[model samples]
Target chain A: MPHIDRRIGFMGSGQMAEALAKGLINRGVVTPNQICCTDPVQARKDLFRSFGASSYDTTLEVVHNADVLFVAVKPQYVGAVLTEARPHLTPRHVVVSIAAGITVDMLLDAAGPEAHVVRVMPNTPCLVGETAAAMCVGGKATPEDAELVSTLFSAVGRIYQLDEKLLAAVTGLSGSGPAFVFLMIEALADGGVRAGLPRDVAQALAAQTVLGSAKMVLETGKHPGALKDMVTSPGGTTIAGVHELEMGGVRAAFMSAVVAATNRANELSRMG
Target chain B: MPHIDRRIGFMGSGQMAEALAKGLINRGVVTPNQICCTDPVQARKDLFRSFGASSYDTTLEVVHNADVLFVAVKPQYVGAVLTEARPHLTPRHVVVSIAAGITVDMLLDAAGPEAHVVRVMPNTPCLVGETAAAMCVGGKATPEDAELVSTLFSAVGRIYQLDEKLLAAVTGLSGSGPAFVFLMIEALADGGVRAGLPRDVAQALAAQTVLGSAKMVLETGKHPGALKDMVTSPGGTTIAGVHELEMGGVRAAFMSAVVAATNRANELSRMG
Candidate 1:
């Protein structure tokens, strides 16, 4: 468990920050009163205030108030925000950044060389409490800082501690992968509609099937191929569908999507 | 909630029957003592016995003992099992069949015309308590029987009441869809590994990404395309990946898989 008394802060009160704050409070990891945030937009600050958390207009106030600060600004704004709070950076502060293309070295450069930093790549599903997130610690970060970040992230979804080099793959697989799945679900519903089901019924069933299938994979800890075999009987409809998917080259399509996304992430990081 | 005291029985103690029984007991819909099963295999009967449910060797005994009977035999054996229990079935009995490709007309024919029947198409995720099921009632079934069936199936996962004509589509979408999704998840993991992630980490993220994305679709009541747009930024990783999926004909592939599966299901039903 993370420290209940720790004051958590967000340098930017964006959607991702709001999601983390909501998850942390909902999971009883911290109280609403223990959360603070900074955002330039008045409406965004009001959104945090509506949730019973304190919100501010500048990064320095959040830095002064919080022990663990999340850098949740857009990638372009990350360096500016961290540098604004650099003077207040202390050994007590653990800075965690969720900016998409920003690396730990960049955060360390902006927040000062002695500052503790952790870089995380989280998907949009954090809003729905099922995020797949990965994190890696900077040189200045302690093991306790890594544990705290892991605990905080696990409240939203499953989190993995991995080498920083793997974060781009995480960005590809869990980050961009959601869009690929959304497309697949829509296509599946279209198939059902074509097969005589009502549109709404098809959509609901399509989404639920994806949810259930993913749960089976996670809970069984069985190789997905083994799980697929469990559902496919000899000469059954499942095998027929699987055959069509194979003939259509669905596997290669998904593989290519991930590879493209990872390459793009690498490109974006280099540009950042 | 369905009647707590109503006795439930499985006409055949197969994997599907066990899953429903476990779901019912776990959800507090029924007690183990309220459940009964009949199986020719001593091992299967013993498995039910081990779970504190009464098991018998004869369908007649189960029919006489239980008010709500699940016709869980294989498609080929449904006729023989229902015929054997025909004399024992009464007006109080509600026959719910999960036999794939076996129609209500066939069940009614085997159990006698006055019999109440409901046909359901449930996927393999029922074993994990995340089933996507659809059911339709026969002419002899009452509204109360339909409600009871809905309640029972909902305990395992989401259930829809639809016309019998659309069941082939349901079978294609939710029934056979899991295997397709499994193959996609595996491919996504492979892509992640190709991008430099460890295999275990890649697999976990891939599955969680699917689960979370599906949850966003179900929980937000938003169109999947809109959700995809939420994650996609201009010239970003998600759109890059989506572009690859589009170029690879991923959507058409999924749509064709469902259509192919539906056609196979229709063929199997005709043969049955």
Candidate 2:
């Protein structure tokens, strides 16, 4: 894909905004002069400036200065941010919201009917160009707008397009999934540490194992079970590990976690 | 570190052996001529040939032709294979064994007193240049021999040097940890499918999330909890998902899973 060089604006200067901005700059997808950010908090503006991007004091100013508007404020403040920036949202602009729990319909409703809005749920790893992000097109978003959003996200990591209804599950699995994985890695490292490996060595081993295994799934396109069976000899150590995971009901716990997050997303959508 | 090419000899042509050989060749760390694998099974020998490596008819021929010998046979037959190869083994040759539940002492005894033997536990992802492998030096192996083993393993992924006692835990965590992670990814992908995302898309998302998150911990050098906190905004979608994970005891279940694997590894070590 060609470099996008989009004139992008963010309504918040939080981690998500910074991550996106950094991804854009790192990938040469967007120039510093082409990006503008605003946050009510002065500290956030300072953070934005550290990326060599322009910063404004208010959302309206950011929206007025860019062709693409990213509504990256907290979900609780989305309504106010949208209302404040509404005047600056012109017909040529595409509005994308990274606000968690904010639905496409809500984004459309707040940003105006004609706004080409899209809702994206991106995980924390976006800061490192390895994020798993899912996008849902708003009622008014064109295929072009969706493609543009995807191009921007591709600079960070893989991007998925799904119906708005599935965004919550994305929020649960990928957005929140990192924490679960981190905890697992930490626990595994602790197990290694307990087994008498140095802390750094154990941590690195545990982490590299996770990274390599995930890559196996993606690169091979094999069923996880089939790929797993390949690793596990009959009565080997892998089967022993699988036996423990089965005994502990790991599958059920993760299932429940995703379901709970999806249900909460629905609740937040309804509240809006 | 200088690029050290290891002349690896595999005493079996099974999946794990072939995977390791392919891993070495794929990374250009070992040339096709440098690797000699032996298997009585004709089909397995053919499979090894297709991977651009030479195959021999007997363990003696392979052990005689190589600097490092890997005993990759099933644990039940490892003693027989080691006995067959012991006559060709010399003090200059480093014998490494990947047979699960086999001990360094067992391997050393089979290869004889003068032989430099090492015990390694490697996962299946090694086939893709991302294996997590743990190695423990035996009584006769020198630091130079250990460094050579590390060099060979670096082609696949991260290699750790640990006391022989911890090989079982390494076996449990990484040797079997891939299956545990595969199950988690599969379960999460199913949850995404349940929430209306297509199967392939959901699988990709779940797999990539696991991969990216693991990379974050390895590269960022921060505590997993710190990275988790960075991603999660208060009461946001991630926090909502995290709450569900906590409620479902995801952390506890995962911890127990690792503990179960580690304990099982310890048990297997005792059996050996």
Predictions in order: chain A TM-score: 0.98, 0.93
lDDT (tens digit, per residue) of candidate 1 on A13-71? 88889899999989989989999998888898899999899987778889999999999
Look at candidate 2 and tell me the lDDT of residue B194: 74
In model 1, what is the error at residue B167, expressed in angstroms? 0.9
| iRMSD (1 decimal) for each model | 0.7, 1.9
What lDDT is reached at residue A210 by model 2? 88
Off by over 4 Å in 1: A1-3, B1-3
**Tens digit per residue, CA lDDT, model 2, B94-201:** 888888788888887777777788888888778777888889988689999999888887877878888877776777667777887888889888777776678898
* DockQ of predictions, in order shown: 0.87, 0.52
Per-residue lDDT tens digits for candidate 2, residues A156-225, read: 8899998777787788788778887887788777766665667787778788888988999999999987
Which residue pairs show collisions in model 2?
A238-B176
